[model samples]
Target: MRRLASFFLALYLASCSGPYMGKDLFGADEFVLDSYKIREGKLSILEMEGYSVAELGDEDLEEYQDRIHEDDVLRIFLYHPKRHDIVQAVSEIGNSIGYQVVGGEISLPDISSVKVEGLTLGEAKKKIEDHYARHIQDMEVFVTYKDRIVRKVELAGLVSVPSVPVDGKIRLFDVLSKARVPTDANLFKSYVARDGALLPVDLNRLLKEGDMSQNIVMRGGDKIYIAEPSAASLMVMGEVARERVISLPSGFMSLRHALAEAGGIPFTGDRSYIQVIRGNICKPKIYTLSWEHVIHLPNDSLLLMPGDIVFVAAKPITEWNRFISQLLPAFGGIEFIGKQCGSWGIFVP
Candidate 1:
């Protein structure tokens, strides 16, 4: 029974993917460096600079990120020329000299209120000391972040009404797990919008590759919007064992994973011209990786994300189907356009 079932499954897969089965791609060894296709209406890799995923040695967090916000607890130390009794009493007494920022200001013992909101620790300490200088001859003020109030980021898109709370020293990576973001969410486009501008955060690197450089500090009241890609799953087409759509994995799906999911590179699979099409439909980036390169490189050398389309090219895609025959060298990206058009205009590669 098991043999019969296996035979039937094999036959079914063969018939289902008969047209795509073919010999190895020509010039596999000849192709050296993986490069982009300029004529495929695909966007150049240079245009992806705004995304900032490829930067090196970037700072984890900036000094300005430590700026004061409302509802924060501040530990203030006071010094006086000859008032050791008053200083000791204040530190040993009421609220332990820890003051909370209320209405953008903290009410000290003598000073009515000192505005410290939107200021750094140094700026706040200077402001507080200046405010007290008017009343006291040589009073000093020191301020530090005793405790940051717990704040929640408004997580919008691709989740079940989700929001990630930050108690203290939280990161975008930590809260992303709390949000339970799906693999189908477009990590490349995900960002934290704060103060009406997007922060330089690359969710793809942080979530998929575990790149700490991209793990930005999370702030309260940040709007983290995770966008859905044009396609829910990656389209794996062209000369392979079985052309299909592969759902993205939680971490990342490499080219090997995609190939294995589609019953792997077949006996007749083309070993040349494996293209990984990324970016949007109208302006995609086609990364041409030969099978020789994939075989020799590390498994994670070519990790895939949602909205990626992997195409194992054989010969030119001339006579793919009746409609796409005229399209001329159209590979897996056709399906993306077909989906965007909401019509079965061209057959997917």
Candidate 2:
């Protein structure tokens, strides 16, 4: 009789200990949740407004023309009313095909090598025209830029293609579209690194607002980096049906939306005290909001920042009852094991 009573006592103690043991093993401290807070003033969404592309002026054209570099290929077309023979001769020598600029100079048959390296398209055409004018009258010279060899930019981060070969004048948006910016790209945080200077580029403004001013003209050796959105997120924990990390879209998020996305609070949770914990583990700011108050007063809705923790506290009586209910199953299992051990003549103190 004493052995049977002792066995029952041990089983009772084991059942009661299960909840505390589980708590110790799986305490809040056991799991190291992310505590990195999104610093204030570190992130901001760009204001979207309509904008227009500025008209390219003569100065812009002049600047673009000045970008001609060595090793570029130029096509020279010559037409003469009386000098068909000369034209034929030049075409035979491949000068009519294309002139490859080498060391700022181009070698033409029967004409002295001209230094057209640092010259604009107009200046280069004039030099070639002057050369042909000395030999043939009524010679029309048309210089067409064939291929560029020097100007190139490197695009990295959040783009499909990393290395982009730029041939002519291009803007920031042009390359981004051509390279295929990912949908999740943090365009507001994109930047251009040029000549040891980091220039902040708001691609969101350029795309949504049509802000052409934010569209910077790309240059040779420029490095463009479009970053992914910050990993800072809000977490819904404690008594929620689905505990999850809510990613803030465009750095803006609300408490109500986060809770809804987390599958809402369970019946056991205390809706009256929904806690929003902000800041790091060492220093946390806990703000409590009443669901009842928020429902009645829309203005009472809280805006949640990244790295905030929304914990729906559980009702004390409900949680205790839940713990006891979970322990009952273990007690029943232990009781069965005790009876089987006694039947097998296993010693019980």
Range of the 10 consecutive residues with the lowest summed lDDT in candidate 2: 27-36
- lDDT tens digits, residues 1-349, model 2? 7886687556555543111111212222111121112211122222111123123334322225454568888876667888787666655544545788888898876689988987888988788889877876678777767666657678887788876756446777788888898777665456677787665455565765576766767767888887776544678888789999876533445567777888888897878767766655665656656676445533213456656788887776675676667668877997898899999999654
The CA lDDT at 304 in model 2 is 62
The TM-scores of all predictions, comma-separated, are: 0.49, 0.52
User: Candidate 2 — what's its lDDT?
Assistant: 0.64
lDDT scores for all predictions? 0.64, 0.64
- Per-residue lDDT of 1-349 in model 1, one digit per residue for the tens? 5875586456444433222233433232222222222111111222332233233234435322457889888887788879787677656533464778899988777567888898988998788878877877788776777788656789888766567776447877778888888876776556678789766565766776677776766767888987776423677887778899876433246677788888766545556667776667766656666677777866545566556788876543322342344333443464568686667565533
Candidate 1 regions exceeding 4 Å error are 1-32, 35-114, 120-126, 136-151, 158-168, 177-189, 226-233, 238-242, 249-256, 264-349
* Clashing residue pairs in candidate 2 (N, C-alpha, C atoms within 3 angstroms): none
Candidate 2 stretches with Cα past 4 Å from truth are 1-66, 76-98, 103-119, 123-142, 150-199, 208-213, 218-234, 272-308, 322-349
